[model samples]
Target: MKTIIKYMLLCLLAVNTVTAQQNSQSINLSNAEVTPYEIELTQNKTTHILFPSSIEYVDLGSSEIIANKVEATSNVLRLKTVKEDISPTNFTVITNDGKYFSFNVSYKGQPIQLSYDLTKFEKQKSKKQSEVLFKDLGSISPSLVDLLMKAIIKKNKKELNIKSKTYGVEAWLKSIYIQDGKLYFHISISNKSNLPYEVDYISFKIKDRRTTKRTTIQEVSLKPIRSYITSQKINSHSKQDTVFMLDQFTLSDKQVLSIEVNEKTGVRSQVLKLRSSEILKLRRVELLKL
Candidate 1:
């Protein structure tokens, strides 16, 4: 009985040792050591890899291998080896903020590993994204309101002054201005009704008002350059000043231009109307550097 118990303990210890070895297959590079950043995966097998941040782009060796982007707290990369001859191939990954990484995908059925090279990934500035207004909203100058007022006064143009109040929020189209082939809308929003109101999104477009509810209306594309509402949320009884930039467009008598604002929560929304008369009365302003 004593001999049997000793043999069983030895067997259990061997199994545990194998399990630990299998789980610790990852290669780490924290100690400034130069090691190969490679992984050996079997053909037709899928492997998941976790990264330090969100990934934006990935380049596989070929289209045959499938690479999927997994959105998580941190970025996850899913890679599969479909073809047999695709072993020993190289791949690259680029994070949304421009962090770069490379790896070798093999079919030798080796264990999983990681490679971290401080010399290669020294943490550089992330590249700017294409979301123009959302990214630049926080950096909007405090003097923007004064500049807009000065421009309106200098031009001496009649203000559209189109305003609306809905769901405890009041919005006004102070004026319209054009600079460098771009149209700018100066807008003011006040939360006077004491209800918590926040701007979710703002959109500018031209539509045929005569169309029926089910009719399809043509939309005009306008990109935003600088906007205040796009950047922050307004609380109850507070005021917000903002501007929108878009391609230069001339409104026709048959079509109407509209700016729609939706609240972050609840059913509160507001629309500012602009017809040919108001759009045609736009003032020309000097282009200020952002």
Candidate 2:
């Protein structure tokens, strides 16, 4: 009876091992069929590939027949081939999330696997000129950059005698500058009180003086040009400076653009105001050449 019980246990163990091996083989076959990206291109034709997200980086195995090495728009890549080559080529694109999308360019005839939406592609192309201008502004001096900052502060002081708010921390409106149809604000935050201040985040909104509800107003969001600091932890008796940029557009007299700063502790907030007059004053700044 004991020998029969041992034989039954061995049979069960062998059946389990066989099932596990079969599952492993199925998984391997499925993985073999999955690919990053695959498409065929003609020997002397142009091909464009559109990606889901904006491309952050790109790499090419060789630049022999690639007419345009790696010209990438926000979510589009343009590859042109002039002649056929001996060795194969691999093209890879790194998206914002760091995921790699690779492709192999096999020299073939017509009936390629390339498709794109022309309306969306043209819109992405329009941003190329503005993107180049933003990069050039980074090389300018902060002091010279401060001219725009001073302009914004001066507008606030002249129009409204309102001073900056000070809870445990104090914020000052430094300057407002415009470059290549983009609005930018420079500000300084100081914490001299005993309590430490943790920044929650900064937000921009346009409010209508005639209406009380802010949601009714239409405004495009603004972002920091260079991500120098997002939400810094501010210790007591310390100060820091930051800059922000908004989409280029003019506001009417009835509209007011507000920059709101929220604290993590929910104790206090500083709201900076920019009216049409202030924006117009910034337009006349020397460097802007409005």
Candidate 3:
């Protein structure tokens, strides 16, 4: 029985090895090349290929318009991009095999020599970390907050305080920490108000630049505090204070977080702002934890 079990286990292991090899072969490329912002790959066998979900291609020249075109087949992946209405820039393409391809652009119907180096591109790409932080909130100003509050109140479609909405709130991100590859945003909410109010939910309006669509990325609702006092004075004077903490929040490249508060009484809402250094600090902390 022991001998039979051993033989069966060996057979299973062999089968698993074969399966893994086959799976790897599906995406194997034969000859791969990378230019500064471009990549070309050829496959050894006819296998279905998928384009990369995200890619950043940089142009060396000063051009207002740049476009990228990608094509993938069973055995090849090709990417091409050109600057419009400007002289072409000299650039390099680096291949995965430690090889570089150099190409130059045409300027005024003249060929300009451009030297391409794969190592340089790799260095440039690696120097900049692709991470998002809370410092991004600083761009939210008083005027923008007013506009967003007006929009949200309009969405609610209620007859609320139009005159008492004299107060404004802002958020300053102090620090961001990352642990285990997850992001932790530390922010301080500044409220400029004479009357006390309860904030029900904090809504974040995230804009998708690629699609030009606005979507709410996060809606953090405050845990309601129960009270026995039911008098109007008690309700109106009740001050709500709390810090929000979120775990495992992930950010995509070029994504920004716009925070807004939804109040139960005394004006409708407030907006928060974050900064860039705070974001980088958070990313560094998170990376260290991981």
Candidate 4:
């Protein structure tokens, strides 16, 4: 009976050794050594963490805290502790650009800072992406979209002749590009007047082809998802270039697309009417590099 007990003990020791070895091997094999950022949370106030890209997912290690992405914004996360004197916890955030972020959170009566902008940190800048598609981009890689946008700006080709000229200010549609269910509009504004053309705003909308004085005009607005423009002021005898990205769409008959640019605090507004035929003139996106 004593020999049998000794044999059982030896078997158990061997099993424990194997399990420990497996665990050590798994821990050592890593893609990257990601150090978790330490942050303190409190119940009295909320903490905000700003990411470079839209947040895709968030997971908390414990229920001691509540966290969520801020409404009406894609890149800001709001967090707060549930109660006072809670135990420490950890959380993970995955962003649309396929970057992973880890945080170790501890409760503090008063946190030193409430807002953290990760975008400003050089270490937090967007690098290589993981294999994930952005929801807004619809199965398209966010990195690819960014690369294409940069490529378009670098190319800067004036391939289209569509324009609306008035008030000594001319707005031209330099190009229209299509890729991955998106439309890229390259535009240029030339101001020939002696005064600078302060652009108030630009609008792309679909409206009825003909509106009667007695009837209400039906309209639909098309807001761009992103844009690449530094300034809106077109100085006298100068020009400015811009690019806008929007979801691809097709209009029906009796509907015309309008691209309107309004002057700031002025009445010089130019509208370019586009028919379905004109909008169909799309340049397929095929760039080797960004």
RMSD of each: 20.6, 20.9, 21.5, 6.8
| Cα deviation of 58, candidate 3, in Å | 56
Candidate 4 stretches greater than 4 Å from native:
1-36, 43-48, 53-83, 92-100, 109-115, 121-131, 165-169, 190-201, 210-218, 229-240, 251-255, 262-266, 287-289
Candidate 1, lDDT over the whole model: 0.65
On the 0 to 100 scale, the lDDT of residue 124 in model 3 is: 67
Which of candidates 1 and 4 is the stronger one according to lDDT? Answer: 4
**By TM-score, is 3 or 4 better?**
4
Name the candidate, 2 or 4, with the larger lDDT value: 4
lDDT of 1 by residue, 232-260 (tens): 57778888777766667777777888888
Give me candidate 2's TM-score against the actual structure.
0.44
Against the hidden true structure, what lDDT does model 2 obtain?
Answer: 0.61
Candidate 4: which pairs clash? none
My TM-score estimates for the predictions, one after another, are: 0.46, 0.44, 0.28, 0.65
Give the alpha carbon lDDT tens digit for every residue of 199-274 in model 2: 8887877777576565575665656543235347878888766666655667889888788778887676788887
Q: How many backbone clashes can be found in candidate 1? A: 0
After superposition, the stretches of candidate 3 with alpha carbons farther than 4 Å from their true spots are 1-168, 209-242, 249-253, 266-268, 273-278, 283-290
lDDT of 2 at 82: 61
- Report the alpha-carbon TM-score of model 3 versus the true structure: 0.28
Question: For each candidate, what is the lDDT?
Answer: 0.65, 0.61, 0.37, 0.84
Q: How close is candidate 1 to the true structure, as a TM-score?
A: 0.46
Give the Å error, residue 46, model 2.
Answer: 37
